[model samples]
Target: MTWSIVARDPETGAIGIAVASRFFAVGARVPFIAPGTGAVATQALINPLYGPRGLALLRGGAGAAEVVHALVADDSGRDHRQVQVMDARGRFAAHTGTDCVDWCGAIADDLCGLAGNMLAGPQVLEETARAFRENAALPFPRRLLVAMAAGEAAGGDKRGKQSAGLVIHGTEDWPDLDIRVDDHPEPIAELARLERVSRERWVHFKRYLATGADPVGITDRARIDSEIAAAVAAAQAQDAGEPAAGKAPAA
Candidate 1:
């Protein structure tokens, strides 16, 4: 009933997950992250405990494989659940319970992990992982979405799509970007639309939010507006394939 991708961005060290399923609010139950620690996804008769418990183990310095083992070994429903883990070091691990529905399996390596159950076929996972590996130049969130969209096109969730989600952690316990399309008729497309809409203000606005280094971030209205305006213009220019105002294009 669900499929997901958990990964670490080699360039920025950010961790993220993109998932879709023929179920309501798949976002609420499947994805979890511990920022600088790692990311986890639990599905197919999901053990919600896997999300928090898995991250706790990773935060405790367990390897990806060990985290997956500890999660499954202690659960009586191990034969009916599916889980995936990606550690800060790029190690990834996955598990598909023997009792999961047809077409259940997983793929993992240093780059990413893909897992699903009650899927159309193995191609769903294959195409998803392929897109993630190939779309290296996309913005991190977009790259994750592109990969999930590709999986959808390959006949995602044999039952059909209803919900999808994208979550990412930059360097904090909280997420940098978290988007969910709960109960949408076309969740993946809706997620894509939301992702694009986020750049309009949310992305830039979040930059002003307090961070660990400066808990009392900028508060001056004049400064916030001017800086946000400048960031927006620079982003828009970059989106248009033009160099940002007063800045040189990348070499």
Candidate 2:
């Protein structure tokens, strides 16, 4: 019903997952990440437990392959499950249940995994991996978006499109770069646009935090607004066409 990719940016030590599907709110159900541990994508009869369990295994010092092994080995329904995982150290692993609907498969490599069930064809996973690899020069969010676009182009979930989401954790704050198109006509594209905007917002926050430069008194609400506006504009200007490229910053 869905496909997703979970990865860790080695340069910045940032962990994130991007997912899209014909299923509504696929992001809410599929992608999971622990700030300093790893990322997980659980689909195909969607065992919500995989999200927490995978994180726990990684937190306990298990590598991606080991964590996935533990999850599949413990579940009697292994043949009906699909999961992808990337540990903090950048090890990657994935599985597709044999019982999954037709055209199901997954690919894992270099701290990244792409998995899908009931896809239009096996090409979905292949295209996704290709997009990710080809976009190595892009920022994390752009790379994620490109992979998602590739999947969609290669005949996405046989069920069609509905919702999309992106999550990056282990940042300095909660809700760190989390964006979702809960139910939209063009969710993947919308998610990409939201991610771009989120990048601008992060820049504003960084400027505020690093410079202690506020437009007004600490107590003035209006001054706070202006300072934020200015910072956002600056960030946008810097990002637009300047070739934004860097791993997500460490938590």
Candidate 3:
């Protein structure tokens, strides 16, 4: 019914989940994240409690493997549940119930977690993990989309795609990026388009939103506009393979 990738950005310490499924609004139910804790994606015959409950455990200092173990051990539906977790320290764990549908399972390493049920084949997850490792240079959010697209190309959701979502958390309580497609003919492509649109302003503007360290964040509209303009200009330059104004190209 779904496939997802949970990952931590090595450079920025951001954590994220990318999910696509035949299920309606899969994003609303799976993929739970808390910036200071970790991330969880619970599916298969999912027990939604795992999302919040698992995050609580991570916040309380449990590791990924420990959280997975605790969540499964206490559930009567354990035999049908599929879950994967990544802790703040980057430890990872996955569980696929004994009774999950064929082609359903999970894989995890410190760098990422890939899990799915009702998938076209194991390659759905394999290709996702491969792209994730190979595309480390992509911006964190775009890297997740690229990795998930590789999974879809490998034959995602045996039933076909209906919805897709990407949720990312950096060093803040709220998401750095969150976008979902509840229903779409080509969900992943639609998701990509939405992400592109968000960059025009939301991506640049979010930097001014209130954060833990700054309760009243960047109230000056003129300064905010200036930063957004500069950010837009820099992004445009980077996209054109030119250095940002007054900035040197990467060596």
Against the true structure, what is each candidate's TM-score?
Answer: 0.93, 0.83, 0.94
lDDT of model 3 at position 41: 95
Question: Every model's Cα RMSD, please?
Answer: 5.0, 5.7, 4.8
The residue-by-residue lDDT of candidate 3 on 1-251, one tens digit each, is: 99999998888888899999999999888999989679999999989999999999999999999999999999999999999999988878999999988799888765799999999999999888887787777788778888888888889999998999999999998899999999999888888878878888999999999999998888899999998999998887776752111111121
The collision pairs in model 3 are none
Error at 30, model 3, angstroms: 0.6
Task: Tell me the deviation in Å of residue 147 in model 2.
Answer: 1.6
lDDT of 1 at 50: 97
Question: For residue 131, what is the lDDT in candidate 3?
Answer: 78
Per-residue lDDT of candidate 2, residues 1-251 (tens digit): 88888777666777888888888788889888888777889998888999999998898999988988999998999999999888877878887888999888887777577888989998888888777787776767777878778888888888888998888865543445788898988888888778777765563454334222444325555776788888777767756764322122111
Which candidate leads in TM-score?
3
Select the stronger candidate by TM-score from 2 and 3: 3
Off by over 4 Å in 3: 241-251
Q: Rate the local accuracy (lDDT) of all candidates.
A: 0.87, 0.78, 0.87
Q: Which ten residues in a row have the lowest lDDT in candidate 1?
A: 242-251
Model 1 stretches with alpha carbons more than 4 Å out: 241-251
Ranking 1 against 2 by TM-score, winner: 1
Candidate 2 lDDT at 154 equals 83
**Reference-based lDDT, residue 232, model 2:** 75
